[model samples]
Target: MPRKSLPALSRRMFLVASGIAAGALALPHSVLATEPEHTAISTLAFDGESLLAGGANLVRSDDGGQSWTELPAPGPILALATHPERPGLVLAGLASGGVALSEDGGRTWESRSDGLPEGEVDAVAVASRQPDMIYAAVQGDGLWKSENAGQSWSFAMDRPWLEETEHDLLTLASVDLATGMGGIWIYAGTEAGLTRVPDCFCRWQDVQPGNAMDALVSGDAPPSEAPLPAGEAVRALASAPSAPETLYSALPSGIWTSRDGGVVWSHLVDRPASAVAVHPSDAMQVVAVLDGTLQMSRDGGATWTALAAE
Candidate 1:
């Protein structure tokens, strides 16, 4: 049976839940802080070697999710992406504004937002096959692309708008597939819904268009199984390099899994999830943020172990 969807998040709750709260600090602090110092997490990334959790701050765990150590972050990180071939290369989208690049894992970072507007970068993604190609979704500036890594950027597309208000993009991932235009697709989880654009930087389209997967030579049909719940905002998206077709999405309703690329989906965790990450090589090893806390699952999503922030 399908799990029941949770209540919709209010505008204010959505912002905080997405990791853009006003009080989010940049400096590193203890993993587990007292009530007054507690920080809410908004995103997660498992780069095969280290597990990173970002939001009001940042923390990394080298031994899976067993223990965590805080790292100095540029600011409240709204999104994170890792390079497929490079172990320590990480790109971070900052809530404060701009993007940051970390070469020695998450230990240190340098500003790499050249050419990008000084606005909250809600989402960032690195092409797995072409690490130099980076994409960022700025709060109001829309999507920006950088072919020379994050060294500099150029406008690629506009932010999604409904009625007259522009919706924010919460997450992004570069999936490796034969997308006619190229062999990869840039997937974005927006306030409006899940959309993807060929790495060619063309117009974004819904994931369910009948001919959506026409370019796919695998003969897979466009996503038709269990569709995403209407009006539920997608908070985060994570895909494993070893299992390119598999995806994990964090939603106000729960964590949904897509095994056939985006062609089909099944609800896994039946609760509001703020962020999710899968091992870069192992699709079954996963980590997710539930109710502002972190949980880990070794046997896929069948069972979970709450990782204490301490």
Candidate 2:
């Protein structure tokens, strides 16, 4: 079905608070006639021109943020990863115990959860170099892998990280394989911190404190509508395809960028961003979602301009 843009907020109030001209802002096109009650956007991925966003709802957009289309999937989407080589191939990790694959640009979807444990799927990663390789992090199951392009699955990690602590895994990102990173390096974001698992899936290491990992372990009753805690609680993470050494992490304070391959980091943005994605064609072009608002940056995080939502 066609997507619906968010409800129009008070433009006069927004402009007075943000000090921007309301007339200059472009309104979002109503992709759907009616908006759903809950829309928890957990992850976002781009396929050159179009964007695939997963959360409580599965959605796609071809004209940046101007218009969106809702894509029906098997279950509530928690994570999404687009195929590196195949433009239309996309995979979605659901809150239920399975993953969904779409070969025809999300017009239709099929479930692939033969080996996945019956639990919420927290994270997913597609190997940029090895397009056929897929990885998923199950809430109670450490990690699962699909080598046949989501056709079949196997346990990638011997032990599940979710079992080690009460916290749950939230996000996953793969480093560019061409950088000699060896295999598709996967980074798992959790309440404890950031966990690094080599593509080989031999061992997992804690790369949170010393490394550029910043995270927060929320209590059972996390705030229903509040941003994560500052200084900790990694809201999101994205790796640059052009520069493997540089990765960006979203924290409560703002966004941080690391140039030394997750070793050293520097602050990039001050506003809290819940999700971020870099354009595949232009590494410097970035789009971030903050508190239901979308912002864009073309100068590699140097400056940001807010995109209006209608």
Highest lDDT: give the candidate number. 1
- Residue 248 deviation, candidate 1, in Å? 0.4
Provide the overall lDDT of each model, using Cα atoms, as 2-decimal numbers: 0.73, 0.62
| Shift in Å, residue 231, candidate 1 | 2.3
lDDT of 2 by residue, 1-310 (tens): 4545322222111111111121222323424423221224566777767876666555677776555676654555667777546788777777655777777766666677777788777677777677778888788667788888777888877442443454555677778633223635686666555556667565565443322211222212222122223226565677777666567776656766666456556778787666777776676777776655566788878898764432
Error of 2 at 34 (Å): 12
Q: How many backbone clashes does candidate 2 have?
A: 7
> What RMSD value applies to candidate 1?
7.4
TM-score of each: 0.83, 0.75
